[model samples]
Target: MTESLNISIQFGGGAELLFDKIKKREVDLPALKKYLPDCQREKWTIRELLLWIKENLLREREELFLQGDSVRPGILVLINDADWELCGELDYELQNRDTIMFISTLHGG
Candidate 1:
């Protein structure tokens, strides 16, 4: 069984394009941007991103429990740019060009 859904994603580059493919049921994680360079950081792949959604995001798990995990707003997922926890989390209703940005928030000096 395959379900079709579309969500808004931010961060520019290929995120927008990727969302289009997603709406068509194309599960190409970072479809648009296969490699997003970040100065001296490693670039994540489309495959990797999709895997993450299936492994974690799409997974039905505890709410607050994930808050303290590494995929939280400050560590993995962005609070403001990411999905709304109360709404549906990964299962949230995605619209055409909604806007989802993944950020690593931190409190450092």
Candidate 2:
């Protein structure tokens, strides 16, 4: 009885290199209802979405994209054009039509 979450994912500052060189994508994450009752929520949090991104969208070199269950250092995450840090970082709950962007600051190091 849950609806799909339509969101936009964008990679910039060379972060797209890790995503098959694609800079933007419109993705649909299934409703949290599909998860275990204990983990299910009214909406998907960034923490949960990160795992889903790693499993579904990441093409390779997970280590380069993630660190200890979160995005690696030197990478910037933005949610709906606002800094994720200001939006509670990983704890930010995502909503329909949300735009999540990842921009890597580390490149050619």
Q: Which candidate tops lDDT?
A: 2
Give per-model TM-scores.
0.31, 0.91
* Root-mean-square deviation of candidate 2: 1.6
The model with the greatest TM-score is: 2
- Give the per-residue lDDT of model 1 (tens digit) for 1-109: 0222334333222222323323223232332233332323233322334445545344243232134323344433332464455445544433434444543344347
- Estimate the lDDT of model 2: 0.88
Question: Which ranges in model 1 have alpha carbons more than 4 Å from their true place?
Answer: 1-8, 11-73, 76-83, 107-109
Clashes of 2: 0
Against the true structure, candidate 2 reaches a TM-score of 0.91
Per-residue accuracy of model 2 over 1-109 as CA lDDT, tens digit each:
3888899999999888888999999998887778535674677888888888887888988888899979999889999999999999988989889999999999674
In order, candidate lDDTs are 0.36, 0.88
